[model samples]
Every structure is written in structure tokens, then in C-alpha cells.
Target: MALSSQTTALAQIPRVHIFPTAGEAADAVAEHLLATVKRNPKSVLGLATGQTPRHVYAKLVHAFREGKISFCDVETFNLDEYCGLTASHPDSFAAFMQRELFGLADFDPRKTNLINGDVQDVVAEARRYATRLKESGAVDVQLLGLGTNGHIGFNEPGSASDSHVRVVDLADETLSANQPSLIELTSVPERAITIGIADILHAREIVMLATGSAKAGAVRRSLREAPSTDCPASFLGTHQAVHWYLDNAAAAEIG
Candidate 1:
């Protein structure tokens, strides 16, 4: 559990925030996001899609409906998308965003960007997405959800530290972990187009959320272990301004 030399040299000791319940943790994250938006109406947000973020998105939707926030001027970029799935596909990350957040919020469709998972040439798509991210300046806040295997944005185990936006084959653990989430697709996706670990690190700030006992081990490893490709999320420890939001269950194994 000792910090690696590289991680020790760069990390400022990430802030960990634990809440009594998952909803409470989500509430805190929502407030932080709202604060970021208030500080910069034109803020570019790096967003995540999954069960972990559903509550956060719901809170944002409620905020929008209550006249507390508006995403009309905010631009967003999704973290990853399953390959071979079109934006409109029911199981696609784009569809998840629409169903969970974008459809209910005031976000402008033109300003929201996501990788074309079904593109004929995934390499070109990766480059295009990366270029768009660069043109937007730094992301004000990058929201993340931990994978059971310690990945962030599909930056699976063995991913290089300097990796950028690219297409990656999904690990078996990832596929198994995500299989239950897909209601429409009979089979899980084997590959994904993801914004790389390096790109995620470049964001001005990062907010990672983990809830439930299912994520306890991964949470422990990510925070207590040294930075390594074996646990991609471990690399977040090297970022100077990363915040971890966990419910008691997810934080169970951390200490």
C-alpha cells in the first residue's frame, strides 16, 4: 500500500470525502458541479456515464428545473463510448447521457461532444475527439466513476500512463461488470473509444465517485496502492487536485 516513487513525487495527497449514504455523496458532487458552472457559465465539463452518475445527473436535472442552474452555455465531453454503437443506440453512452442528463437539462446539443463509437475508423475518431477537447481549453471539472477493476474511462489495466484518446479492447472484467447494465444488447461490447488517462489528468479538476460495497476493494487499491497500469485509477493519485467522493460502503476497504 506504500506510494510508488513516481506517485509520491507528483501527488499532493488527494482529498477523500466520505458520506453517510450514496444519495448524500451524490448531493455533494452535484453542489460542487453547480459551483463550477456558476463560476464559469461557459465551463467545459468532462462527464461520465454509468449507474454511479445517475443520481448526480438526476440532481442536476432537478437543479435545472428549479431555476438554480442552466447548461445552455456549458459545453460537455463524455469520457468514453462503446464501439459499434451509434449515438442513438439505446445502450450507447450518448443515449445514456440524453436519457439521464442532456435530455432533461438546458444543455445545447451542438456544444455537447461524444466519441463516434460506431465510426468506420476509430483511430481517426479518437484524434478528432482529442482535437475538439484541446480546442475547448481545459475542462473545468472532470467527473468520473470507478470501475470494479480500477479503470477510469475505459483506460483499462495495462494502459500506458501517457496514453491519450484511443480505441481500446475492453478487459473481460470490464465486460462482465457492465453486462447487467445493458437491457437492449444481448452481448456486451468488447471495445470502447475512450479519452485516455493522460487526457483525464490534464483536466483542471477531477471528481471521482464510488458507492456500494461492490467498489470497496477497487477504492482501497486506487487510494492505497502505488501508481501502476495494473490499476489505472491508481494513477489519479498523481493528480494534484483530484477529489474522491465515496459512500461509507465504498470507503469500507480504504482504511
Candidate 2:
């Protein structure tokens, strides 16, 4: 695929590390994340929430408990949140972060920010989140997970590569993908607030984790496809530095 003004050639892409198993990939990724954070002791991180990062969060929490990592100085912003849900809702992203990382990690609530999805003024909240990201400076490292559809954050198919923080309509697959275990797909929110492709490109570094056979096709397309709204993550090839960590299942279709 030809490179557009927005994307770099695939040959220039760097730092992809594939592993034999999901467990191995998670461990390596956690080491890279924690080690990078230890160097600064106070990094502004762009964090994504989902099943892919569950083990990585467990690693971080374990380190904090063992006195090997401290999050008191780390500032974090989540990539997206489901609309109409309060932070305390069991299915909310805020609650996921609380259950997955913060509660055990001693992360300061004052320094951790999550976009309020239930606010009446969702657009205003998105703009405010963008402002907070700018003030925090370039995210030291953004931890992301791929959707089976190749979307990043909530920038689904046809999302502009230059998109920024905004209110987004959830794709049909995205809604189903986020549906809780044993829960009806109709129960998931149809809208979300997400930091867009451009917002993530501003990060100092980007690390994306993809595991399982379900993500194999999307993972391959994300790297092989040229930068296009059709595959928003394909734009990552344009980034100066991006680390793609894939387990065997996710890397199955890729060379």
C-alpha cells in the first residue's frame, strides 16, 4: 500500500515483539511499562481498559504491593468510556480501572482522570479531556489493545487518522465486543467518548497489545494496511516509535 501524507511506509515501522503465548507477551509488556515508568517516577500515561490488559494490570498491582512500583506520582488518563454510565457503575470503565489497577496499586485519585461518560454535555467533557491531555504533556507511553475490527480507542472503521478527543458512535462490533460476560449485547452503550487517533499519536511512545485468535486478522491488517480511515490503527506505522506486542494467536496471520 502506498503511503499517504498521514502514514509512513511499513518498512519504517519498528519495535514489534511477538511471543509464543499470551502470558509471555503480557509479562514482557508489563516489564517494558514498569521499567519505563521507574525511569521517570512520574509519567503521564495514556491507559486503555479491556480484557487484553487484565494481566498487565495484575503485574503492575503486584509490583506496587511488593514495593517495586509506586503510582502516587503517575498521572493517568483513560482512552475512552461508555456513555450513560457513572464511574461507580460495575460495567463502567472507571470501575474497571478501580477493580483492575487503582484499588490495589495506591494510585492517587487526584492524579488519575477518567472522562465522565454520563455528563449531559459529552462534547464539553471530551474537549476538557483534550485540555487535560495537553496540560499533562505528551503521554510517556500509551498502552492499547486492538479490536477485532482494527479500531483503536473507539476510532472504528472510517475514523480519520487525525481525529482528536470527541464523542463517538460505537460500532456494532465494538458494542458487542464490550458486552459483559453473559450479558446481552443490547445492554451495552451505543455511544462513547474516546481520545482519537491524533490524540494517541501525540504520545512519546505507543505500545499496543494483541492476544488470542480472535484478534489475528485485525492485527495483521493494522500493520499491513496503509494509513487510512478504513483501518485507523494502520496509522501507527507513521509513528516514530510504536511497540506492538503480539502473542502467537494474534500474530498467526502476520509474517
TM-score for each predicted model, relative to the true structure = 0.94, 0.92
On lDDT, the candidate that comes out on top is 1
User: Considering summed lDDT, which 10 consecutive residues are worst modelled in model 2?
Assistant: 1-10
**Cα RMSD (Å) per model?**
5.2, 5.4
| Per-residue lDDT over 148-207 for candidate 1, one digit per residue giving the tens place of the 0 to 100 score | 999999999898789999999999988988988996999889999999999999999999
Q: lDDT by residue for model 2 over 1-255, one digit each (tens)? A: 111232223324457777778987888789888988899889888899989999999999889989998889999999999888888887789988999998888789999989998899999999999999888888999999999998999999989878899999989998777775312235788899999999999899999999999999998888887888887889998998888888778877876
State the displacement of the C-alpha of residue 171, model 2, in Å, after optimal TM-score superposition: 0.7
Clashes of 2: 0
Every candidate's lDDT: 0.90, 0.86
Regions of candidate 1 where Cα sits further than 4 Å from its true position: 1-14
Model 1 lDDT, residue 147, Cα? 93
Alpha carbon lDDT at 233, candidate 1: 96
